[model samples]
Target: MNATETFDWAAAGESLAESVTLIAGGARGTGRTAALSLLQLGARVAIVDLDPGRIATVAEDFAEYGTDRVFTAVADCTVREDVQAAAAATAEHFGKLTHCVYSAGAYRAQRPTLDIGADEWDLIVDSNLKGAFLTYQAVIPHLQRAGGGALVSISSLAGRTSSPFLGCHYTAAKAGILGLTRHLAKEFGPSNIRANAVCPGGVVGTRMNDLLSELHREQDLVELAKQTPLGRNVHEPDVVGAILFLLSDLSRFVTGATIDVNGGILTI
Candidate 1:
């Protein structure tokens, strides 16, 4: 088969009909979009987020997409007990848990290295790096008990390259996830558990996109796009497609990989 025909995407289409997925921080942004995507693919979903009302609202809005395929939980991925509770609830609600997407990361765009404070550094590190670590620590047992599963961490373009608009700590933490993904792949591959990451560039159509849209100048956006050979920014759907592939058996035997969903951006 050619590169385009490597995996059977049709398997993803219907196999997910009875599948159950647990998404961390799935109430909004890429996380929410991802949850909806998985549900659309026919997976029963339990979306975890920090906001009860927002989760409830989004859960209701997308419930029809899931039919009985959707559910919601209000839990902080950074908090261990909350993660434990959410995982337990997801398994109980769906009657099975097969995939885990650690999509809860924080980003606060600001002036480059010299302009940021110490506390801001800690905040970004704690959220991006520590949060990913916490989610893995809390969910490992669940995945293990399930006997085998797929674990995907959503990273960023900053991990692959430095950006003037994003702080160094954010980039560093995002980069750390790539290393972590490789380590987990080696450690858990024997158990049929695969670990991978999606590194996305400036993504449009998310809360972060709209927020950053307000902060970035047109020239800045264009300059950012220029780094990529594609000459355009990537959309959420583009990144999500790669993510969905990583989560599905379509990428079976693939592990410890960090996929770049950037239009063409790679640090020089």
Candidate 2:
């Protein structure tokens, strides 16, 4: 049969209908948007965040889906026990886990390399890079149990190139995510698992935006947009779309790939 005759476009739409996804840092920002988008696609969602208040707020926000379809846990991704428990609880609650989106990360006001302290460096690295490592460690077994699964990590355009608005530590941690994702893809390919990363540039209305607003004027963002071929910064949905594609069967053979969602900025 030809490719067109063999392709099931309807199946692609229902790819995630049976998925049970765990979204780290799903309380707000791109992670939160991903959770809502997945829920709309008929997937069961489990969201984990460090803040108890934020977890509760997201739980309420997802209440429309009812308890059977949604789960929420308070977890600090940097802590091994916390991440392990959350992952275990999610699989136990939902009966099986199929996908994970490791979106939990941190950033600080831009600082020079010489001015960055050890404590600050540790905080950023542990929060962004180490947290992703721990989350994958915790979720891999559950993915294995389900026979096969997908993992998507949120890297930054800073990971690919230097960031003008973030510190070196943030950039370093984001870069680490890319390397880690590639390693996971190679190591787990034999087990029918896939791993990928998404690198977004200057997403607006996110926590990063709030931080950048304090550091640079609105004009700076406009100037940055003008440099992009698309003439606009990324939005929450743009990053979420790339993530959803990675999670769905539409990208079944796509692994160890980094999808750039930067509105044509920083193309390689």
What does candidate 1's lDDT look like per residue over 35-101, in tens digits?
A: 8888777678888888888788997899676546887888877788888888888777777787788
| Model number with the top TM-score | 2
What digit string (tens of lDDT, one per residue) describes model 2 on residues 201-265? 98888686687678866677888888989888788999999998999888888999999999887
lDDT of 1 at 257: 93
Clashing pairs in 2: none
Tell me each candidate's TM-score: 0.88, 0.96
Model 2's lDDT to the true fold? 0.91
Which number leads on lDDT? 2
How many backbone collisions does model 2 have?
Answer: 0
lDDT (Cα, 0-100) at 33 in candidate 2: 96
Q: How many Å off is the CA of 253 in candidate 2?
A: 0.4
